[model samples]
Target: MGNITKRGSRELEGDGAPSLVEGPRTELHTELYAAIMREDCTAIQVLLSSHPINQPVTILANSTSHRFLSTQTQSIMPIHLAAKYCKAQSLLCLLEHGADPEIRDSRGLTTLHLMLLHWPISSTMWTKLGNRTQRTLTNTQKDAVRCLLILCEHGAHVNARVDDSNKYSPLHLAVAHGTSPVLSILAQKGAQVNATNESSMTPLHMAAELLNQEMTEMLIACGANVNCAVSCTGSTALKLAVCTASSKAGRLLAAGVSCIHSLLTHGATVNAQDHEGQTAIHEACFGGREAIINLLLEYEANVNILTRNGESPIYMYLQHSSNLRDRVLLTKLLYCSYPLRLTNNQGALPAGIMLPEFHLLRETLIKLSQKLLSLEDICKRVISNIYGEKHKHHLKQLLPVKMWNSIYCHDSAYLLK
Candidate 1:
């Protein structure tokens, strides 16, 4: 400590505390701040031994950054600043010198929260968006992980939550922004995998919403509830995954698919209905995702599942008919008893999806809707439903291979074309 001008000429008071006779109340902690920043453990111990702990000080934030002149200074605890900047040695010193790791700053974020907020995210989070950035855990990230472990070791509450409106737990922040090492540290330290934020969104839900397969799998392995629904929409992790998949393509689309598979394999309800009575299959169909539709169907997703307006999955599928160049797929869905004659709350029928140029297609659909199902098709529907009722998601595993092939691999293209 180079005798910071404000801390000059410290004299011993009657109580033996360092009576600073020269500093403003606002800048009294300048020397202590310099000591912490310099990672001077001896000086830190000396200052903390005499001065009051948890002193709130105002200092310019982000002042050294090239982007701005200087940000408005806000009062923050020194422990938070240490953790936020990933001052690993300084943070350990602070905690060892009696700093409360669980104490919240003005933003209601604890030391663990700020540590996670500053940790570097890996490429795994952006691989879904087609970013192929090479992932090399930098020295800074290692320091962040070490800081997290130190905080945890020093009795930082792993489950402590932010007091703000988001009500984010340390685990939520970890999953939202932190790397795997940080998340692992928090999880091993007893962070709650199923903890929900103010939106009733769990860590797994946030992972699914971002279509982060790695985080999704990690949360599942930690015993995350695969079916936790959002408070406002009753949207489960599966539904949210379907929605994300519908909007993305290429690598991102595959990432969403992987996340959905992880959730479903971990026992997510394939047929979970939302507040509007929309299931995952309905969303898949509405998005015109052929692969997604097939996956949902194989998991025994109900093709005839209805929405609040009485619209079925096939109806949603037809809503994007331009994408369905293969009319045979429609015929196959009809064979699966997609309820071609069902009407919605507005009296919209399956044929309503047909365009004027598609006259032959419309006529074909109306005639098909009027005709009774052939015995083979009816048997396919009846037997499949019966088997699904008994086997549920395990239908493929339990059913005989030949029988499963016979039911799912019918040659309907020739009939439609």
Candidate 2:
């Protein structure tokens, strides 16, 4: 007992937590890991009291499961395991017993990374969509925050990339998991707001992809570049928001709209194109959400712009039969005045792909396409294309209030009237 006491006291004599030292992957390390997985704090204390604290505990990396999912890997320390499983008491016990928070697993994820990875979600609120158990997330969130503070206080690198391959910082993890409080804490502690992941995507891109307005605004306030392009697709945050909005449930439409508005108000280019020459309007049309399409148009998104594949917004709208019932959106696109006879890469005309049920819509578009343009329609198209980039102050003076409000409000009815 005396020898064990002396060893325990001696292990804590360093300036901080002990550094990881290479050692045998013995059964003793396995027993220690089993104790951690079981959250057996007493056994953990005994294991540390009996053996050296810095000996390596080898766990296999499971990177092949999925690119987005992280698995426990070799080089993981006891503190990382405890944090990952949300065993706060065991984690505290390990920390007090000299486990280092700065130690990284084989993938270079720190204790901080593991904490964010396993942070609790509000099962009662947002869990209906998943299999998360119904439990109050209040205590779980508090515990997560406590662990985060402990790691930071013990010199965990907040901005450290999780792995050399992905370059995902702790902030990126927080954003990906939708942990807002942890995100704020990381931002307050100087996590790089514009730090890019392997795809050259900033945290703002993730927030926009999730269509989370609150997270998007927070990242913007933290100075995340609203218009940063992903190197792989050359997609900006605004373009990502539109693409993401198309796939979400209809109940989340308002949140998607709010996110788009936030990106636009932050000076995101409404007409910004991706590598394929598709704008946010193109994504909105493809998504088939009437509200988002209206919102993008209200922001003066150019509807007539063609993709590299030669698909215009009108062509994109007609390509998706799901959008057939959205008469207002169809009307808006028909009025945008692009030549409908142009062929896409598939050689499909804007009018060629119409379903049988959309006969009335097809008739209306044909009549409008053939009718001579009114003086007002000609002025509207010219203003939309020519003065699209002019400052609002000049446009406010140049155009009549009704016409200006119709364009700015995306009121297709008023504009068409």
Candidate 3:
């Protein structure tokens, strides 16, 4: 391998050398990079026909050739740039003209790596120009899959991970971006579906963390371990999904799909605990994900499951509730039968943890605790267990249609009623 040489600046020596980057072939390589960046396919074809196809092009964002010398300079091959910019025609033409598919850029990213990281800029670009429809977004995804197929056909390492920074395989990247098409492509091309990143997080863990139902399902179908945990924290994919979805700031879009439901459907342990001994239910409680909490409860999740720190799901719910008037959620916990008498590491009861303004909540729980369990209530609880537990497919066979609907279809808002 020829070293890129640079001169004059001591900083340049640490980054690039005088003899290589500033060499006589600089202008030709620069022009090639510009052509690829601009998606100039005609110029790319003409240039490749006249010179070496694997020529290294260094894009100097400023005066310096060494990337480390300045924030601007980046060393990339023609194919890597073409793949990143999603210049499908330019990418294919360069590949047809003999561009090496396996060339690593400054970040140790291959053309295949670029394809995995491909993003849709149509939303941003079209917003300024016009309006990009959903079809435009989908086409961007299809283009990425096409590029990946080309690289895989050229014998690109289908399971190659990012060499610099965190070791993220193409599968991990595909999961992180929630790109179902690339995921399918990678899996079909023999990519390791169970591949983990530097954190020992599998693609399922990543999909779970993003609350990406489609990707989570795909990875599971591809045989990704549903209960795969982070090596350091013992955090399962289900826990990660709950935590990620619950922690979102805006109107929780995560409530739309229950990753908890997906993982459990695939045989994930309902009470699987993380490094902190916190289950997915604990995470859902902490995030105030009422729908998820209900789903977990329906699966017979242990309501009193505690974290390593002695915090129960109820404790987490009370501690995390930003508004006490989030009463339906609070009451759902009560209805699910998490003990109000239970205390946390700080020795606070569920009521003791509440603010003064939440006296009504505290009073309601205390009053409910004193009420004798009636035969009707006992039967309803038993019926709920039979109708709503993990074997949901058996509901129609086990119960009358009206009873099943009454028990399963009702939301938390109907819990007190």
Candidate 4:
């Protein structure tokens, strides 16, 4: 319960100085501010003992100290400033003096939020530089996770929402910022793995969006919802994996396809459509992912299922030349046991619109059409055989007899002869 003391406008008062209406304007406070700025722990300790203030001094951007701290500006506290400036000693001092770790700035960010935001650079350095550099920093300084642990010890809420964005908890921020160490701490502290933001996107979604396959797998291992749909686009993490097309996408796709396998095994609907009426097949098709398409088909994806716009996965493939192989693959998959025909709702077949480059495909469709016509002629012959000459004559009357006679006979009288 130390009290801050002020002397005259120019000098500091003694420890037992009379209470003034306002706090200290002493050179001691100024020196403390400078000490905090320069990370001079020794000077800060001496100044704190002399003025004996229970509350830590707040520093503005210009490096001036305010005796009375205000949370009105941006909800920033002294510890937040210290964390932002990477002054570990000053941060510890403020924490020791009963600094509110959860005090949010105008942005609704607590000291913990600030710490997490600034923590990644340290972790990234460790990740890139190896254990020797990590030991060097750990021996001489606190790393990001250590800082997070300090904040947690000071009662910073591990799951507090960051500002009004409501997009990230400390865990989300840690993962988003690539602070692997901080992410582990947050996860261990019971941050929700499936926690979502305004976009209904879990941390896994964020990780997938960034193509952080490692983080994505970690989140999934921690029970992140693999099929959680983003609010904006209703895209699941698997869909995102197919869509990103980055190296991260490759990793996520590997993991996500496995998840998809499990989900399908456990009875998650493969044909489940999103808001746009697009299923996983649609996503694979739109993304032009030949491998993913094959995977989905292996799992019995309904190839002919139409999207909201009446476009089947094959239609989607045909729209983009980038997806030609996928289109052809889907077409083959759809027509493997059946004839190759692109029929609309009215049963009208897509004939002239055959894939221009697929010569074999065009020939197959033509042969199938001719085979169907021949089958109809055979059915007519069987009926004629059953009903005799009178029925045959009636059937011949219905036929395009003139054209048929010209093709089969040298003259109309030749058939009679």
Candidate 5:
């Protein structure tokens, strides 16, 4: 009922007020944009089917008060407006009236890509932080989920990559946002499970790096490649899980074990090296997670695998040998066939890298590195390597479920020959 104002299409009146041009078609374009944003579905139906303006017409991005865009989008269409504001019924009306589902904004984001950027991160955080407000968001989440399904069902491309520097796919956004429901919808729509960003990292790699066990397993079940190398770094999902837990203090202690087990069972190449040639075991030792180290060994991880600098996992462990809160892990790595003559490219042996302040501690580790494993240690290592390498996925099938933890993933390292 009031005078509509669109940027480019508007002209200044004599009193210095900006107002819409007095043309029939331009007026119709202005009305259509407003109707879609307010979700006036009936009004939108009448405007589109009867107006002289084109159904796929767009307005300037600044026309709205809330801008969800990162960079400037030259122009955004009715579908973009409806999606950004979450006007589901209005969006469906426009789509039914022949709106282009795949039309992209100047930033090259389709309707689906644009909507996910504004996803309910607060809702996900509440659930993670154990707040009671998540129940209140249930109906709202259902609406958002339905919006995504409607977009996908109307032919929005699930694998369409953003034309920005990040080059994120819908799957990448879903994982980064940590919403499994939205991720599941995209996957069901045939989103590429292994789609890479500009960094060459897959959704599975992101899941692993985030240390989300449920997401990691979901991607694996959806056929994510567990062994896929990351962007330029050549780090796989197994290494990512351990590396992220490296130094977050005790908050992240053993947090990656569940994700590591999922990756291993789904076929993670345990000994696969990064660009620097460090294996998951090398990282696990550096992080000082005995549980993760033991889990890797259960999968026949080669502790002696060298880095590009020729450093072994034992050398990495001694970096904190004196500060070790528990000696059981250091002892386990020693018994797991750590090479006695270990040396990096610099010709420094594993025991030589210990902190200088702990001279007595360094000498003790140097002596221990050269000693033979006790019979109990030897038998444990041999049986663990054999069972894990041969029957990785059937841990419960071959042993008592109770002993599974003690033998393969715990400090006990118990095993049978």
Candidate 6:
């Protein structure tokens, strides 16, 4: 074995059982990792200079063998390590030294993928950095972006799918993680905006799920499929927006409306239903958004359309809402000016079903029934006035006496009395 040196200063362990300098090599890699994490480039250079490039130190896992033996034994390359630690300058240094961007650990994630996967950290840290410090990218983000750019420039497959999990691509990761900077870089590098994972979800679906309005708009601008349904459940980005129970539903709804306009302009069907036979109207109703429901109706959504379970928008609202004021408002909006006797597939009229907390709705139905009866009485009176007493007698036999008395009684209000 060759003689070992510390900081290239003194030769040690000539006739050695184990070289005394071996301890320094182990300590050097650890120091390098620490320096990278702290963004201390100078300390990293000093550490790197102390060791020969071919001297094979177990920098990552501290194993004596340089070659990985087991799947768990595989150590991340320095660039992979830098990306994992969010050390941009260290990543750049490794990339500069020709570290493999395509290196995969036990998880098979590329350095870029790892950076994208660790996105929440980037978002939280960068947001704080952006707010507290300069408006420019933080030290951490600058390093991350630089690493990502290097990978992209080196043909790192901007649209590479993550290992065997087709649920995410690099674009999906970017959008899902809220890594806007990384997303921009990938988009500019020709990543497919409408690419579906195993779930058949485009990047837009991820942005909608995260309720990231800015990311949704960015993906839309890049031509993501607004109405593309995920194969897992056949949910579109708009449908997913309303499905979430989060308070961001309002913002998501607004985004969905914008996406709907774009989709409709591009020939998307407003009444398109999912695998469960639930339309965007069904989603809006379940979400209890009167504004969203109105928007869908204005787009000519089939308001009375039923799901596979035989529930219409009104039924969905009744099932999902416990508030009386909301039920009353929704009932009036859905049933006003429409005939209730229109039978659905199950032979039940839309207005006949008793909704919970909607006593006002039941009262409204009774009122409508009375109005129909009054119209019949007026038709009979008109016949008596124009045709003759004989025709009036014939009409009187056809009409129910109770209905007639209720309409024409002028004194005592006999039914009430």
The top-ranked prediction according to TM-score is 1
TM-score of 4: 0.61
Error of 5 at 134 (Å): 5.4
lDDT score of residue 99 within candidate 1: 86
Name the regions of candidate 2 deviating beyond 4 angstroms. Answer: 1-49, 56-76, 85-98, 106-108, 122-137, 164-167, 338-342, 345-348, 351-376, 383-417
1-417 in candidate 6: lDDT tens per residue? 122235322222232223333455555655655566666767766776775422333442223332322122223456666777667677766666556677666676777788787743444454444564543335556766776776777657787778866657899888776787666678889999899888778888877766566687778777777778888788777667656522235666576656554444544466778898888777776666666665565556665576786666665654443423454455443332222222335855444335545556556644653444355544543433343322444556776886555423324222111
For residues 333-357, write the lDDT of model 3, one tens digit per residue.
7665533434567776654347687
Per-candidate local distance difference test: 0.73, 0.73, 0.71, 0.58, 0.72, 0.59
Q: lDDT tens digits, residues 153-248, model 4?
A: 777787888867565887788777876556666777778877887767788777766656667666766767777788777777655655564222
Better of 4 and 6 by lDDT: 6
lDDT of 2 by residue, 1-417 (tens): 011233432353353433322233333555677787776888888788766665556532332322322354454577877788677777777877888887877767788987888888755556455344343466677777877877777677898887777788898888888887787788877788888888888999999999989889988888788988998998999999888887776668778888998999999999988999999998888878887887777777888888899888877777777776666766666656444433588866565346677676666665555677667767666666555534555788977998787555555664233
TM-score, every prediction: 0.79, 0.70, 0.71, 0.61, 0.76, 0.65
lDDT value, residue 410 of candidate 6 = 26
Cα RMSD to native, each candidate? 7.2, 9.5, 6.6, 15.0, 6.5, 12.7
Q: What is the lDDT of residue 397 in candidate 6?
A: 70
Question: Compared with the true structure, what per-residue lDDT tens digits does model 5 show for residues 1-417?
Answer: 333444344433433443434446545665676777677888887886666322344333234432332222233577877787677887788778777778887778888887887765446656464445676566567667777888988988999988889899999988887776777778878999999999899999999998888899998888788899986999998898888866554555555677778888889998999999999988888777677777787788887688899888877876665425455665566556534434578977555345565566556656755677766656656666666545745865777776565556655333110
Candidate order by lDDT, highest to lowest?
Answer: 2, 1, 5, 3, 6, 4
Better candidate number, 1 or 2, judged by TM-score? 1
lDDT of 5: 0.72
Best by lDDT: 2
Candidate 6 global lDDT: 0.59
lDDT of 1 at 334: 66
Which 10-residue window in model 5 sums to the lowest lDDT?
65-74
lDDT of 3 at 228: 77
